[model samples]
Target: MLDDRQTRTEKLAGEIADAILEGTLEPGSRLDEHMLAGRYGTSRTPVREALRQLATTGLIELRPRRGAIVAKVTSEQLEMLFIAMGELEATCARLSAMSMTPIERRRLGAHYDQMGEMVAQDDVPAYTAANTALHAMFYAGAHNPVLSEMTAGLRRRLAPFRRAQFRAPGRLARSHAEHGAVVRAVLAGDAASAHAAMLHHVSLVEDAFEQLAGAPAGTAPEAARMKAG
Candidate 1:
């Protein structure tokens, strides 16, 4: 069925994205469709679709003659992307604090609780799915369609890196704690606090990713200071 094919394509895309984030597929490495198809035990159609989808996330580049290659994301580019994503998410959190109804807030809280359970069980994949849902709830709670769309777009672009952060030791617990801060602030209708909490949470995510990637540790402290302030 068409739905099955789509699901397979998405699964393949996520696998490829994970490989890139884990450094198994280094930046600038060529991705041969036929090779991937053989490796994944799938047809070339799904492989091609998966690569095209990855291209949309800026994780891979599909060239006319050269096929697909991993996109090189420089440190500066990563920093800028995180900054933009953080600000946008913070803004959404602030708006959500001001706008989310009681029922919506409760739903978000319930989702967070589920994420907590996932974390306690050390279920990274489940936690990641719950984390994504929690964020989607925040976006939806903002009640601003345009803002939600923009945030969703940025989130997609950062998906691989954000998912990679979970691989860091103790990151799940820390991430859950950060989410608690945001949840409490939102439930209390404290816009400023919600914004700060989200901003700090996003910054910490960037730091976790950097640590995983063996990058230099310079921006994390500043982000921590912001969280403290």
Candidate 2:
């Protein structure tokens, strides 16, 4: 029951995050728990939990006496977050290139192959979920528990922005191509190349999000509806 409740909270958090990213919930807008519970058709319990979780992500701000409001982030702040995240991810790729077991490398390869099918089908949601899995594998293959924990935490915070990039036209194929570079370098044990490729890939991700954020209001298609991290 606890696990199920946790899942519901996480799901609600993702939905609310998506609305913020898509401009449905503008920055600095109040997030009333009661209203949100009604909007998402859940009780106040999960709605409250979801708001608390999103607060950690800097997506929403919680006040003492007041309720929550969407946190207003500047472009520079967003860039800095992506910079930190990209650097950590690059380091993980570098270490994995040097240390991952042969079997682990093969598994990464197989996972990449599966993602290719997702791209071919133009299945944005599947591709995004697989993208998160691929990064998780890279983090685990690095074999540093502390690094993995920190990286994954930041990733959860960046989930809404990172996943929103795929909604851009042709971004799925481009992202796959970028991952191809990182995968090849990791499989071949090229630490330098893997690091460089992963860094470059994340930089592009930041750019994609920026472009998506600037689009006209209400132009967004229905979000693929998957959790980012």
Candidate 3:
């Protein structure tokens, strides 16, 4: 069993990761160990662990003397990750459609309903959370543990970019619709359609990334709202 300090270290890691993903910590921003320790009411140990994990995820760079700085996303890297993620997610959706059990299907349906409720309330955080859960469930339903694990790792690497992408106008609404289509295909066991829907859904994200490729990170209007959601 893990001790309290170890558990706190892991929790701090997750919190820092979320801050990175949500752009609360902007790209290239320095992560000060002392400041974070003071902010989170912990010692330097957990903050160091958190920073180390972020460094591994490419969300931060650990400089020998300067401590950690948030990683900057290049256009090429953004395009590459989105293309790969789309292919992987499409494959997962295809397999999930074929493998989904009745219980899993019902649970997936419930997730969609919950997502709809979030959208109805214009709760972007809730919608985004449900969106993540729904896709995670789809990944599990696919039954390929290896692919699921790899996809999850890639998802974490791409989170910061994704948060920026979501700030684009109409993106969230369109994401909800695309997810609905994917759920429909999965429920009907239409593997091909499910794959296509997922591909197209991720393609939307790719389009946004492409458009923003040349734009300065904080200069773009959508990028400016990275902290909004």
Candidate 4:
């Protein structure tokens, strides 16, 4: 069915995105559709669709004749993206604090607790999924469709870089603690506090990525340095 093919393409795109984030697929490296199709045990059609999808996320660059390559972002561009994302998310958090219903607040808290468990178990993938859900919940709680759509678009564009930060050692715990501040502020209906907390959390995420930027993706030398200390 058409839906199944779409699902498969999405799955392939996610796998390629992960590879790019982890440095297995280095930025600027050409992605051959034939090779990818062979690797994923599929035809070129799904591979092409997957590449097209990634291109929209700013993770893949499609050339007229050169095929697809991982998109390379300059440090300045990354900084701008993070700054924009932080501001947008902070606004959402503030609005959520002011607008979220009691049930929404409770559900957000429950999701935060589940993320903590994922962190404790060292389940990075699950934690990442939960983290994505938590942010979506914040957007939903804000009760602003336009703001939510804009934030979601930016988040998608920066998804790979943002996800890569979790590879830093102790990042999961730190992120959870940061989320706690946001959750507490939101639950208390302190919009200013929620805004501040969310902004701080996003800044820390940028810091985490900066710390890892120098090393090969999977190695995370900053993590090792912290552990050695």
TM-score of each: 0.91, 0.92, 0.78, 0.88
**Model 3: residues >4 Å from true position, as ranges?**
1-29, 38-46, 64-66, 209-229
Compared with the true structure, model 4 gives a TM-score of 0.88
**TM-score: which is higher, 1 or 3?**
1
Clashing pairs in 1: none
Residue pairs with clashing backbones, model 2: none
CA lDDT for candidate 2: 0.87
RMSD of each: 5.1, 4.5, 4.7, 4.1
Q: Candidates' lDDT values, in order?
A: 0.87, 0.87, 0.77, 0.86
Clashes of each: 0, 0, 0, 0
Q: Which stretches in model 1 have alpha-carbon errors above 4 Å? A: 1-3, 215-229
What's the ranking of the predictions by TM-score, best on top?
Answer: 2, 1, 4, 3
Q: Cα RMSD (Å) between model 2 and the true structure? A: 4.5
What is the C-alpha lDDT profile of model 4 across 15-106, one tens digit per residue? 88877765677777899988998888999999999999889778789998998988775666667788999999999999999999999999
Q: Which stretches of candidate 4 lie over 4 Å from their true place?
A: 1-7, 216-229
lDDT of 4: 0.86
**Model 1 RMSD in angstroms:** 5.1
Candidate 2's residue-wise lDDT over 19-130, tens digit each?
8887688777899988999999989999999999999888889998878988876666677789999999999999999999999999999999999999999998789889
**In model 2, what lDDT does residue 1 have?**
98
Better of 1 and 3 by lDDT: 1
